[model samples]
Target chain A: MNAATTTRRESIGQSPRALPNTSSVPPRSLPNDEQRLLARLRQSDEQAFDELVTKHHGALIRMAMGHVGDREVAEEVVQDTWMAVIESLDRFEGRSSLRTWIFGIMIHKAKDRGVREKRHTTFSDFETFDEEQEDAVDPSRFHRSGEWAGHWAFPPQPWDDQTPERLLASQQAVQAMNRAIEALPVTLKDVLILRDVEGVEAKQVCDILQITETNLYVRLHRARERVRRAVETYLEGCQRAV
Target chain B: MAHDASQSVHEEITCREVVEWTSAYLDAHVGEDRKQQIALHLAACAGCGAYVGQIASVRDLVRLLPQTVDSPSESEQVRQAVAAKLRRQ
Candidate 1:
């Protein structure tokens, strides 16, 4: 790993306050293409702004949906996020990737809108959800007593034929995974969407969510486990039907 | 079983601990000591291997799944709105 990644990994157990101020520290220097894009955005190039919105709007809407009541409200939140992005375009230093900055803004607005609407539980309430107290895997899956007590009682069956392409090819599997992701509590959902679905790096994800690496992995593992369970269930049903 | 001997020899971490560490292990985020333990356990334990494989699949599949993009008109509308806001500023 590079020096930056090494530093991020070493910061794992440090308190958030003990970590360096990420806002003051740009995660990395912006890539040349991103720098060019930012310059065009600042120049009031409508096409450039359009490109930015089109690129991120879908992701923003999907992520916002995780926070709020419905698609309409999610759209509103994203629209507001775009306006905020436009307003702040000039002020955006290359501290974070534009994608990271845009996501950070949308998450802030989405949480605010989610609170105002009261349609969903807020992040503060989720803070009490207690990552430490929950087991990502079902405890029943393990034995209760004996030498192998903590070992798998019913280990996951191998998906010999399953691949990413094949899994997505199955409509039932796709639906199952989407439902599993949609059903996640906002805390788990946020990390999963950003880290797994959006393909953000772990460090950038931590930066976007203002979470520690420890919390990010905890939440991300839970999220992935939930989806894995969903796919497992779907596969089991398919087996039974055969 | 073929794994029983190695399982007993490398009993420092259980399948339970392996399950918890799967994501970090897959991401290479765990410490070298813990990483070695988990790697040895995974080598001996078929259950943990399958579980880790499934989680890894889930991680890759999530990004590969089709994203829901906005309709063209909706995209046009957002573009216009953003353009208008940029002009107003």
Candidate 2:
């Protein structure tokens, strides 16, 4: 192998012998990429840090916005998070993805900022109406008094020809899904952004949101159902159009 | 729910109940008994089964989208600023 490629690999915590057989590992895990990135970040490499910031800055803002409400405050929280990330570099142990580690810091900062600004109530106030919110399954769509009572009134059809290809090619359907995400209740929106958008685990979502497991489950399920309904609605619209 | 009235207590969950419990089942948060109840409901109910599939698709599609919905240009600016600050520190 060339000297540069070997150097890059070794920089990422892989020995020269570890180079040939990466097929067993998931490409997305990219332990080598992370290790190299972490090393560069530790040394305050400007270009390396810029790449990391570009990849995750938007996500950090959205997560901070979940707690702080105001966009400006959210931006501030994200900026503060970067500072904290710099300070906490020594504590990172590769136990979790670097993304998750940085996010944990952002969540902590956002939550603290929210509390200091008395915005925590905005984050927590929705729990009371949690019961009154529409359920994942609309009761009106179910029968009320027969063998199928409480069952689906209309069968759930495939969003398209039951294929991922159709959905991927349909711009309207994609737009509908994005719109639905934006329209969700803030409580559900936050959970969806973290769990689905940020790709955080459910357990970690609970910790970040300071919600119970049950609450996290409810919010996540409701978010998924709503997004599914958007695709369903788009398909129905296309059917009517046809 | 009434249809299951004649079934054993373990199989008494309705479509609505199963819908409410679906996330619990998927997340493995419910007890084994409740898991069986949901399983029985899904086994017998085509609609509920489809609901499970559709939600999985929803998750897949969302993951396909960018992790953040903020405009790309704005994100670029934020990243540049953050990088500059990190270097200054």
True-vs-predicted CA distance for residue A16, candidate 1, Å: 18
Model 2 ranges off by over 4 Å: A1-37, A65-73, A91-97, A108-134, A160-163, B1-9, B66-68
For candidate 1 chain A, the 10 contiguous residues with the lowest summed lDDT are A1-10
Q: Chain A TM-scores, all candidates? A: 0.83, 0.69
Give the per-residue lDDT digits (tens) of candidate 2, residues A1-242.
22222222222333334334222233344488787777777777878777877778877886676566677788878777776666556545554567766776676677668767663346442232364476777778778888877777876874433555577677777777877876676578778878877778876676556677778878888888888888888878878999
Candidate 1 segments exceeding 4 Å error: A1-28, A119-128, B1-11, B68-71
lDDT of 1 by residue, B1-89 (tens): 11222334334898998898788889888776677788888888999999999999999898877665457777777888888887887
Local accuracy of candidate 1 as per-residue lDDT tens digits, A4-89: 22223222333322244333333347898887887787777889988888777777887888777577888888888777766666
Error in Å for residue B8 of model 1: 16
Cα shift from native, residue B26, model 2 (Å): 3.3
